[model samples]
Target: MSLRRTRSFALTVVVCAAVFTTACTVASPGSPSPVASTAPDAALQPFYDQKLSWGPCAPYATTATDRTAFANPKFDCARFEVPLDYTKPDGEKAEIAVLRQKALDQDARIGSLLMNPGGPGASGMSALTSIVSGGIGGGPLAQRFDLIGFDPRGVGASMPKIDCLTDAEQDAEREKTFADPSPAGVAAADANSELYAQRCTERVGTEVLANVGTRDVVRDMDILRAVLGDAKLNYLGYSYGTRIGSAYAEEFPGNVRALVLDGALDPQQSTIDRAVDQNAGFQGAFDAFAAWCSQQQTPCPLGQDPKQATTVFQALVRPLIDNPLPAGPGRVLSFADAQTGVSQALYVSAAYPILFQGIAGLATGDGETLLRLADFYYDRAPDGRYSNTIEAFTVISCVDEERITDRAQVAELNRRADEVAPFRSTGRGPVNSLDPCAFWPVPPTSKPHVPQVSGLPPTLVISVTGDPATPYEAGIDLAKALDGRLLTVEGNQHTAALQGDQCTDEIVTQYFIDLVLPPEGAQCKLA
Candidate 1:
């Protein structure tokens, strides 16, 4: 029952689900968004007071498959407006779509349990739908919580979504060579970045893109909390979703009834630092995978030495930069797609077999498996329409981090990435380039800093020692920052919670259902 893949895994498998067709609570309570214990300005009152009219959710389904999977009679959809600029509340507004999953036992139901699945840009509605279909309906926790999913500002179903590339354009981007950091390569990469930024700005004006950061999403979250009639928020955030939950806890500690952050991202680390750590983490994960492969009954694909796995993998993929292996109709495996596919499968051990098969196909001059993996990573539908996940991912990331314009620093980041993860290194040298965020139309709304929080209820933070994206230490650091309990799971996966581990599920259920906290230095071995 785990849809445990990368942040932006294909939404077709993780599409929509219905909870309750009844209207959401229309209560409008004062919240401490930034200023503690204060009501929103008078101009923002209408938005805060508006009631949601839940209706047939069929139109909002991401795909026909999603509708079929979420055909429960209780499925309903609704939208609410939040200020485009929280500072200028009376200005234009943005829409947030919500999908609620009702509890099996209404009399014992606690408040809504809001779910956000990573991507910073991933569709919460899609995530909820996937979770419900995975059979959360009959669980003990489901009996007491009305599960809720909402598309954050500038995301799917939300008005004026952050969009950049067209389907054709995205396809071209995937086919690109791993743009090395050579002088000429850097220039080409920068030009591409500049064009991407410009295209994003052109597609969704400067206004919507400007206010789509974690801070803005936090504000919108509070409004949803108010309208949903919850005195406090009970949230489950995985991967990048933890970023939002962390901020929400910091800004409105009093509004938190219970919180769980799995595969937590460290708010204390600068953007580049986190990226460097992530590179090393992925390399370590690849090493683990190779070691496991070596122990298999059959001969390992990377030969006898697990240590040479990186070199072996490079040998298979490097030549593709110049000569892409023919895959299927209208598609060929490129170096970029090769790396993208490999990295995607490394997120969870569950996908390791798929990676093995893809690599085997590459050896036989077949690239279809690897190509499918890359397509899945981008959420490219069979008809070629993309889910806008990457677009929102870029824009939201731009708004969340301090804009870096220094080519030297970019080069240094590349140097570190190459140093830590040699699988992608060119062996020539590290090259420098300007990142797309450097040219973003909107300045960053927030910068990396220690979360300022107090009077915060005890929360839960889960980390995996072998997680590739959000490194294990990031989880430890986040728990330290928030003074919350840390659960260390020994595994090689992005996150571990509510994904069907009896140990993790029991702890999480206890926390959310009864506000219980795991003991200090808690740990669980992945089953």
Candidate 2:
């Protein structure tokens, strides 16, 4: 539901690759340049020169819909090996699970097109199936490049994954309302952060957690490029995926062939600023949703005055904190579930109907719908098992963002979240609650900076005016920082490009195929 996005209420909706070749021989197997080397201490020759054996995929789906999509035989999976710690390539290693959908027009195939959906924690393996179903890579785009999706280090289907809370524990944690800022509430929040941090450190140890950040993932990506026989990288990245692409551009500008970055995160914003900006984005999206709900539905659950939307919406769901609502047997909807479900629905305007119905049902004391929405957000299977997306998200965010250990700063961070996102905020007074990153096992690796990558070809950055996860200005800022062109989308969603927006998709397809840059300030609206 967030991008380390602090939801204040439910909180955990934090942010949340591959190669293919027809010859069946080694793809590229070339070593990285000195600047892009795995480490100065060790050369990455062994890791880059390895061959990947693509075979029938092991199941990556934990839910019914995903299972159906993944079962299609069109997919071939491979496990690519990379060092867990780049400094010690000869030491412990992690296996990145890569999935490939072979190009339909193999005769005209160009190369492999690697893709990532922004989750920092979301499963690239899971996203590929959805992308294929939605025809993102199917038509002309898929005909040329083998569409690839890989679960980054410690993500879905990857070896030595980051594991923390059990399914039952996760459920229990979600049931509790989290928007209080009182001293006792802050203390409890700190303790919970400590618990989560210690569990991660104990289960996967500090080294793996430390190495699972974006920098590490991009390194694995380069190795994948080498192993898959691609001399240059053709990539599509969304949301946090944009971060990876920009980082790659910064680290290895010469290796890029084509990159399409949509819903970009401003690389220069600090972690707290990024999270807070995202919170504001959500509130803005929520305002749009509330206004839309008023027009589209009878009696407008948000009431006649759209300006009063935040107060009305809060009145609707905030009571779930003390008195939970029944959803289905063995389940009840807490305030955490209500806000999470709403936030999830706000990501794409297409799902607004479901959101309206859920809120309407909530007004009628039926929370099954909203509860289901929250379930989808958490990836909770019917059997009550969960993927390690959230765990990996926290671990990656901790290492990627500059650490915040100061109590005063944390209090300010909480206050800012409440101020900017009162709809999602508890409306409680200023208070300090330690972020899970405060108790992280290791220091951060990446800091906020404007990426100034020279010698990079004209990259395309797409931003939507109403994007709630990675705001519109971030896109403008990122495009300027990277010296890339910006394609403006007039919409209310997370990402608009390459997701069946005909005009936007055509522009992206043209860019990827011919390396043609969109005109400055090119704009499209979702049809």
Candidates in order, TM-scores: namely: 0.92, 0.91
Clashes in candidate 1: how many?
Answer: 5
Over the full model, what C-alpha lDDT does candidate 2 score relative to the true structure? 0.79
- Scored against the true structure, residue 170 in model 1 reaches a CA lDDT of 91
> What's model 1's lDDT at 481?
97
lDDT of 1 by residue, 1-527 (tens): 00112482223223211211110111111222322243556877787688988887777766544566456666678899999999888788888998887788989988889989888778888778777766576787788988888898888878867778888999998787635756678778888889989998898889888899999998899889878877788899988889999999988888888889998889989888888888888889889888888888877777779989989988887788789989889988988787777787777776777778788888778998888777767777767888877788888888887677887787788889888988866565765777678888878988888999987878889898998888999999999999888888888878877766678778888888877777776777776
- Between which residue pairs do clashes occur in model 2? 4-15, 16-119, 17-149, 17-150, 27-228, 27-229, 28-229
Which regions of candidate 2 are displaced past 4 Å?
1-3, 6-42, 59-66
Q: Give the alpha carbon lDDT tens digit for every residue of 1-527 in model 2.
A: 43354211111122110100000111121232323322312378888888998877746654565576677899988887899899887899899988889888989987889988877787777777777766655688888888998889998888888888888888888887656777788888889889989988898898888899998999999989888888788898888889999999998788888888888888999878887888888889888988888887477777878899899888888788789999999999998788888887788776777788888899889998888778867877667888777777788888888788888887787678778888886655655777788898798889999887886777889888988888899989998998888888888888876676788888888777767776766788877
Which 10 residues in a row give candidate 1 its minimum summed lDDT? 16-25
Query: What range of 10 consecutive residues in model 2 has the weakest lDDT sum?
Result: 17-26
> What are the per-model C-alpha RMSD values against the true structure?
5.9, 6.4
Residue pairs with backbone overlap in model 1: 17-129, 19-100, 19-101, 19-102, 181-431
Task: Tell me, by TM-score, which candidate is best.
Answer: 1
